[model samples]
Target: MTSQRAPLEPLVPHPRAPVVPQASIIPPPPLPPPAPASGPAPPHVFGLEKSHLLKEALEKAGPVPSGREDVKRLLKLHKDRFRNDLQWILFCAELPSLIQEGPQCGLVALWMASTLLVPPDGVPLDRLLQVALERGYTAQGEMFSVADMGKLAQEVLGCHTELLCGGLGGPNRDYILQHIIAGHPLLVPYDEDFNHEPCQRRGHKAHWAVSAGVLLGVVAVPSLGYAEDPELAGLFHPVPSTPYQPPPLPEEGFSGAIYLLSKQGKSWHYQLWEYGQVQESNLQLTDFAPSRAMDGRAYVVPAGGVRSGLCGQALLLRQHDTSH
Candidate 1:
């Protein structure tokens, strides 16, 4: 009986629940936009005024002091004379196109006059005049008659004899002649102008080489002896007609040179170089606009002297080390 009762109690039914689908509940948190990248702003492009300010700061900061007072004095004097002479040249260069001829001739004359007044250590005014006359006469196919050229020399010499007497004498004449020969034949005698035709027509190597040398002289003169291991004198020495070539560009170590050209209806523009490589800069004719071209307006970097950028509307020379 007990077994029967237990079986009846087991018959009770079990409760069941309905199934519900949950929605794809939460969407991914919206991805935050990628953070913007950040860096330092570009450096301010250098300008003339900025360059000047920087130069002044560097100068004020001081450099390795040159030891000799006399050397400093000589350099100062040389710089002053160079500035003055270059100014005179640039001033003469500004006349009407018709008188453009005057400046080059004027430079030649001035060089002669300066030589007469302050002949360098070994050169004499008379001898320099003689050499120039000989070259001029030779170009004309006429025998050099010192009398003719001497007249001009005499006038200059007479006017500046005291100055010319300074170093005018022996080996300096030959030395200067060597340099003149090395220089470009920018001024050819009217008769020898035809000789240059070959160069103009065929692109003569001699012509370009000489031109380069002359340009070197022009650019290097102001900076000579201002730096260590000066090569201005060597640069001015005429290249031999043989196979000898100048030292490799890098080896030559040309610090750099500045060239200024004034365009018609435009401002002055400059070209810069270092070890024969041109440097790119934003400065151009528009940068120096409206000012007429002047001779002494150039800023030269001395052979090994340290300086960055040039200043002055006309001509000014200030010594500052740029080797930093």
Candidate 2:
């Protein structure tokens, strides 16, 4: 038995030949970036979307000119004309500087709206700009379409707003009169210099001004003038020069289309109510003509009565909220 066991042991050197290496695990490839957006972008309500656009525009904008004194003077003039305490409500607590390096008529319009909605403390420029930027009201800092402004009035002010057309000749004067009679100030976009034609040589731009009062059958609009031209700042010496230093008068004659606004039964229309009730006077559009600021240039109004984006033709804004 011992010998058999020894023989069995000797047979086995069969062996430990080779060790195979294991393969390491590999991760899958990274995913590719998302594809670019397709098709036309959806329309956005100004001051409600793409607010960054507003910020960019404000950042690149020129410095605001000093126009407080001008506002004060204008307010006084308005008071003298209206002979009532309501004049204060019509004018901004202080004139705002919207025109810096470029034409910011839309900004001017916002400021005007602030003057009406927030009294004593008018719309702060910084606050307005911040809101506009946050809301995406500005269009690449180039221009704010009239349609966007109407949307702003509704969303920001929580009030009703509308837009009307002036057609090939110009805006309807009667339409403007109706709004003014209704006690709503108008944001009118027009040629800054009606005396001059639209030409490259003039270097002028389309401008926005506020019509807050009526002067002897003419619209009383206070404007920011040459705010971008610091060199011309002196022209407004003592008091800053407003686009309409003397206010647009009927005698001056109009040269461009004017946009208008108002509400049908707003509480603010007490004066209009009085005119209609006591004087029995009609708010006739015939009395108003193309303001001196209009030089037959294209103006904007909301198309189809929808108040959210830009559209074709000159128009008026009419708010019908009776609450004021």
TM-score to native of every candidate shown: 0.18, 0.37
Q: How far is candidate 2 from the true structure (C-alpha RMSD, Å)?
A: 29.9
lDDT of 2 by residue, 43-94 (tens): 2112212245544554464332223333333334443433332111122122
Distance from true location, Cα of 224 in model 2, Å: 35
Stretches of model 1 off by over 4 angstroms after superposition: 1-146, 159-174, 177-324
| Candidate 2, superposed: residue stretches over 4 Å from native | 1-101, 139-141, 168-171, 194-204, 217-324
Candidate topping lDDT: 2
Residue 50, candidate 1: Cα error in Å is: 38
Candidate 2 has its poorest 10 consecutive residues by lDDT at 1-10
